[model samples]
Target: MKSETVGSATLETWSVEEVEQAFAANEIVLIDVRTPQEYIFEHIEGALLMPMAFFKAEKLPGQTEKRIVLHCGSGIRSEKMARLAIDAGVTKIAHMDGGFGAWKTAKKPYIGTDMASGAPKRVG
Candidate 1:
């Protein structure tokens, strides 16, 4: 776990390995803060879409017990979202260290558009 100071709040961050472990254990709420088209291109498996364009802190899943982790194509959008979450009174929020690009560069598993139905399909 890593921490970033944003204003008076602290935003925790996780690496790809940590994110993957938490995901496999179902212990985190993974969110992708990118556009629908960007998400359709590729994303970490199990990530929920909550594009920053239409982001509303209140709309985020109210799963207080679970750690909330956000990510984007790179890390910029996720950082912005983290700040918004902090301003919204959310604490201990997190984002992937390098976002989807890093996750892919590390050869981590993901899901993306299916050739046939244009739906999502898991890929390793």
Candidate 2:
């Protein structure tokens, strides 16, 4: 028998710690599925703003090389977005178990943005 270390890049699902590690390593893609307004309020840092409404319409950007973590205000929208991504031939897909809310409750780090009708302002 032989043993080998499983690479972090091979993971399909991610916990808060795992997500944080992935982001820190720049080895995962964070996709935000909430509306622009909601996303502007607060979101995982480095997450790409690809709302669920655009999931089916817009061509998914980025390479399929890394795991994709989808999140929304709640888990619902992100779950739906995950399904869509899977259907669209995205094999590396995951969603925050409780979405952005849980992330906040867990005291995980995230970035906040201005929700006003203008360019988003990044805050921690």
Candidate 3:
């Protein structure tokens, strides 16, 4: 775990492995802070979309006790979202290391949307 101060709030970060394990165990809420188009192209299985362009902390799912893991195409957007979350009084927050890019490079399993059929496609 790593912590940093952004503005008046503090944000925490977790490694991809740690996040993956937690996600598999259903111990955390995975959020994809990317655009709808980006999400339609590809995304982690079970990740909820909360596009940074219109992100609202209240829109974040899970209870305060539940760990909220945020990710983006890369680490940048998620980091920004984390700051926004923290500023909104969300205490249990974490950003995925390297974001979705790292998760994909690691060959971790994911699901992509079929543009034509508008269905989900599971891939690894």
Ranking by lDDT: 1, 3, 2
**Candidate 2 accuracy as lDDT:** 0.68
Ranked by TM-score, top first: 1, 3, 2
Tens-digit lDDT track of model 3 for 1-124: 7888766656888888999999999888898999999998888878899899999997787565568889998899998888778778876578988999999999999988776898989987
> Per-residue alpha-carbon lDDT of model 2 for 1-124, expressed as tens digits?
1111223222144566777777789887788889987776777768999877667623665565776677787678877776666666654467776778877888887766545755555544
TM-score of each: 0.87, 0.73, 0.85
Each model's lDDT? 0.87, 0.68, 0.86
lDDT of 1: 0.87
The segments of candidate 2 whose C-alpha lies over 4 angstroms from its true place after superposition are 1-12, 62-64, 113-124
Q: Whose lDDT is higher: candidate 1's or candidate 2's?
A: 1
